[model samples]
Target: MSEPSGDASGNDLRRSSALVGAGILLSRVAGLVRESATAAFLGTGIGAEALRAALRIPNLMQNLLGEGVLSASFIPAYSKLLAEGRREDAGRLAGAIAGLLLLVTSVLVVVGVVFAGPITRVITPGWPEGSARFELTVTLVRILTPGVGLLVLSAWCLGVLNSHRRFFLSYVAPVAWNAAIIVLLVSVGLSTSEQFTVAQAFAWGAVLGSALQFGVQLPGVLRLTRGLRLSTSLAVPGVRAVVSRFGQVVAGRGGVQLAAYVDVVVASLLAGGALAALGYAQVLYLLPISLFGMAIAAAELPTLSTLDHEDRRRVVERIDTGLGRVAFFVVPSTVAFVLVGDLVVATVYQRGNFSEDASVQVGAILAVYGLGLLASTSSRLLQSSLYGVGDTRTPAIYAVLRVVVSLLVGIAVMFPLDAVQATSQGISVVGDVAWQVAPEALRAADAPNALRLGGAGLAFGAAVGAWFEWLLLRTRVRIVFGPTRLGGPHARRIVLAALAAAVAALAARALVETIDLHATIEGLLALGLVGSVYVLVARAVGVPEARELTGRLERLVDRRAK
Candidate 1:
């Protein structure tokens, strides 16, 4: 009967999660730099929209076949084998999944390349069939297809590495991917000013970078999985279990990815910069989820998979503890994004072609996304727990439900928002239903990647869908597990501390309101002040995760001093 907040595995979970977070932090920082460079060179122009759509289009293959699906389908059964000291079986499981993924992804890559045009049409129907923007998006999609396949294999490598408790390289390996893009973007920026040419060059760079990312992980996977023998046989004993889970996880991941795809499609229909603005906001929005939420869930999964499902007490304690850890970090993140997100966006992106106006648009989208940060992060852990307990189908069902809700809401809001034109005179209506009757009227507003607020509707819809999924998950876990509900046991204190922190942040901002300060410096002062206030208040409120973090910092300092 271990308490929800104080489990024996807490230390190991924290250490492992820290490792995962550290790796993700490095990769995400590099990703931000890559994004910043893209914004600087392309701005929120037609080139930027095409590039963002192109990058995401072939990523359909990766999302269907990548880390989220693999983490659920492959990791649990594989981890169980290793925990039982069955390295040979573990290797066999790894090899089969890798071989299967290779076969599936290779075929998809070829199909993606061959049918890139049709796929592009479906993905970005907003672009006319033979327009310059449309054709360019088609071409970039073809270029990035094979590269995305390579990323799928890289995810397989991650499954092997994480199963072996080598969290850093698998999570950090994307640094190579990001770095390669940055290097090419810089080189091309120096040589040329052509937007289409820049887009093409970066697409090729992405392909090369994908190869590097996969290459870096293969050696480690090989070393750890010595008994591995590659095959496509479905007859392997545990292979059936993996495949069954894989199907359900694919459905789950597919639904989630589809929500994103639909958002892109709708954004394409909005004014020009909506796609790029959405892209910018998402890059920031996903940071905390990847760093804290994904990290903690990843660390817990292998351990959770090895636990006895019949012993519900142990499982509940693990999940509740992890959720609390996630909430303590994410609550304040939500506040930051909502209350002072413009500062965050300006600090990262308000340079070169990424104008102050663009930053404001992106920040507005981010604030809506922030309102759902807690739901999204909490759902990540709940989904992991469901996967660990072999209840993959439940999450899949909810994921689809979430998407349905999101699409209904998103489409309803998007068209109306699109009809509302932004003018020099400060916003005017382009007829209440002009998007339905006047295609020309909507196109007049688009302006090839110009700023628009329509994307925020998609963000708002997504936030609503996220809460629905989280609530369903929270209840389902309670029913499935014996006596406990899935949630952040420490959410109350964490949220209160965050509210207090937000108040202090507001005061700091007011104090600096009239001062002439650069976006970066102003952001640092506000974020730092808010963060410090959160930590101190959380400590006073006796939030365990905060106390643990502070205690760890103090311990490290003492050790360094000695």
Candidate 2:
């Protein structure tokens, strides 16, 4: 358990990050396929809205106690015990935490199933009682609660494997989860004409998927801790430490989940398809954040947890490198979302029953969400670093502040925007190519105002809160590490590269549009052109990370050629 040499540590970090990123990439692609299928079947209607709400409600359990909380509290404690060579104690602590998680999740699952109606009311007040949407949501929530319990256990497995530095299996395991849903969607196609029945099938598929997700990771966890056994005893040496930290981490994660739930509630009150539109946009927004931010942070946490208290310099170095790498990828991704989000949304979700109107709505929401991509991703690494140093309380406090800010801003913006109906004249004033594609159904005089701009307001509020959180986190890191080197020259170079790449991408998109090509084909060409230009521009700017990435790609290409 001794620390690797400094040179070795850097390489290990990069290699581990690459592995995790590969797994996330596959899992995310599968996830996108699952979402695409959902959109094709449900088409952002009332059925889609109900299913989205139901999924979010039970997900509260996993979000509150799942990977984020465990990474912050349980992983660090257990990892430290392992570093100290207390294998027996580590095993016991792991078992105890697992048992406790199951017990609590089981109780919550039962309560969630029984009180599905009341729970739905609290989370989504816009849906009327006795309505099909409300009833379907309640039913789906009941069926999905057990799956939440299973996912909680899967998260426990993730904590174990991560602490042991077995990163690939745990990260790759979600493919099973996504695959289950994909298979179910494919099998039931055309067999069920009703959206309600299709949604029911999806709900059950999700439950089966959760079980497979957990089952796939169990063998790895067992292999890592051969002697571990389930126990409810909290009397182990480090068990109390984990328990105490768990509450703060849970509160911190809960604050984040609360902000999301607030958005859901606000979106629900807006229009029938508002929540569904937000859900679709969110999947696209989260892609880069997961691929870059979570992959790097998750890889670094266990290593950081093992650092000596006197080695503040090492911790500072890791933070800088991780943040820079994250920004390198995410900045361009943000640019893509802002510039070509309509194309991206249209390509992904505009087929079948998902109309051009739905695409426009989701595209706008994505553009707004793009504004917060850097802040949101940066906050993830900052929080992970703080958790590494055993200071969970500060992040928890700032998280609560972020929730308050998001809620206030959401209300202030959403209501006023919703009041202004988009008349024919008003629609002309909002001149954009993306808007030209909107269907007649969305542009009609009787269309709901909420469908026009409410989702964008929600997105804008979330962005404001995300930047606030990032500011607070960055300030704290400076105080601890003495004026972080993350923002001066390096940031300027990244922004310049991203701007150049975005311009090239825009040109590529224009060329593609001029020709008679499908939306999907146009989007792919633009993305490829932009991505290639980004790497070339970044390399030309003397960015070391960019050069390193290029070198890796070259080596990969050579291997393939061989």
Candidate 3:
């Protein structure tokens, strides 16, 4: 029998993409339910705002050091070292990175706990003075800070696993964290009589969940590589080099993340609930982006690390196919969300303590975020390409540009227009200007129309900045990979398959609506049925790329069976 193609490998780009995508789908679904549960329990309240602000600081650090920034640079260097037969070097570097990360994160947790009050004040200056919100925000931050250590360690483990071509375990690890959080939530009742407030309960769950995130990956990492050994030698050849490059990458990522924090700061300066609204919006928007886009990024990395010019061309072709397919699924998704977000939000969360008015506000924010879905996904792909070529500084520069542009755009767009007043006196009318330009947050608090406009502006600014980064990266890709040579007939087939997918989705939606489906059960059924239809239709369309993806999946199952 002919040996299986590299596609047959368990951690092959396509197969791992499918696996990670599926697992992430599960995680995102649970995450949605988790957010919905939280929203229902604590809608637009002091508790919810406190939870959001508390979560933001540690989560921001995680973005910088754990997944987005750190992984991009760390994984490529680690993988390259392994690919070049420097296994010991790779293991030592991994150990060193892990040791350093653990020490730094431990210190951060202590500092965050000791200085929670001042941190919360800086993060959310408009938090009502001496209120429950302020106190709770500080408390939750202290509770959640330790997660930084667990999460950072988890990222290092995941990076090592991915470098060694063991993906399933790492991909499945997030499930444990999700399960832990769910168990905690279920164990604690929603009634006010519960021992801990919902915020406190969730805070505890986060700690347990992050522990699971790190713990689950340990066995696999141990099995797949040499044992970890820490050394005081900061001068380990590749380790120092990787860390220096990673430092630059982290600084760039930190700048962009600081911009994100700026958004939280601005929103917190608004009315009481703006912080929560923005948080909910971000969580919901990231679902599809992270699920598919990050899967493609993860899958592409190992292959990109090993490929020659022709092979690299082929890999980018596969990436294009994958990205185009995502666009088809996600574009209509964006449209549907823009059209029916209010209904979806209301249906999911309107009952219990989450009122209809709150649903309307959250849904409006979601719709604004929906506009940037494609831009975000495209940026993920382009950034992966840049990292694949071992050019970290280019992306760092692009990242800084995005931060600068977004800040300027956010300011310009958020400033309200012409706050003038007029009064009539007997025969003459007199006008007195009260304010030249109303700040958006005040206008959003007092005027809902202006709030929606401000949201639109923020969303538009974000999308513009993302696309601008993509454009710059596109030029880099052209320069690096020659002009117009990535896509092939396989790409064409994937496009046809995606077109069929759109049709299948519409058909599925129609059938569900005809039956008057409602409730979570109905929603789940509709998604399942629509997904099945898309697969079947893509199969019928003779899309070889789709077939290739499915074929590898079958082989992976067969390998496990043996």
lDDT of 3 by residue, 1-562 (tens): 1222544532355577776677678777778777777776776566667788888887766777786665677788888877788777777777787777777777887888899898888877655546566788888898898876688788888788877767666766776666766666655645562322778888888889889988989978877666457764687656776677688788779878888877767665443456666677677678778777787777677666556645555655655655664554455456444644554565566565666566566666677677667767766766777777677788888888988887777656542311211111111212222322344344232223212223434555676787777677767777777433222334455455545555655665566557864444444554455455555555567655446556778899999999
Ranking by lDDT: 1, 2, 3
Residue-wise C-alpha lDDT for candidate 1, range 378-432, written one tens digit per residue: 8988888888888899999999999999888877777666555443234456556
Give the winner by lDDT: 1
Task: Look at candidate 2 and give me any clashing residue pairs.
Answer: none
Q: How far off is residue 168 in model 2, in Å?
A: 1.2
Candidate 3: regions farther than 4 A off:
1-11, 193-196, 309-312, 414-456, 483-562
C-alpha lDDT (0 to 100) for residue 364 of candidate 1: 77
TM-score of each: 0.94, 0.93, 0.82
Q: Ten residues in a row with the worst lDDT in model 2?
A: 428-437
Q: What does the lDDT read for residue 135 in candidate 2?
A: 89
Candidate 3 TM-score, C-alpha based: 0.82
| Best TM-score among the predictions, by candidate number | 1
lDDT accuracy of residue 170 in candidate 3: 72
- When 1 and 2 are scored with lDDT, the better candidate is 1
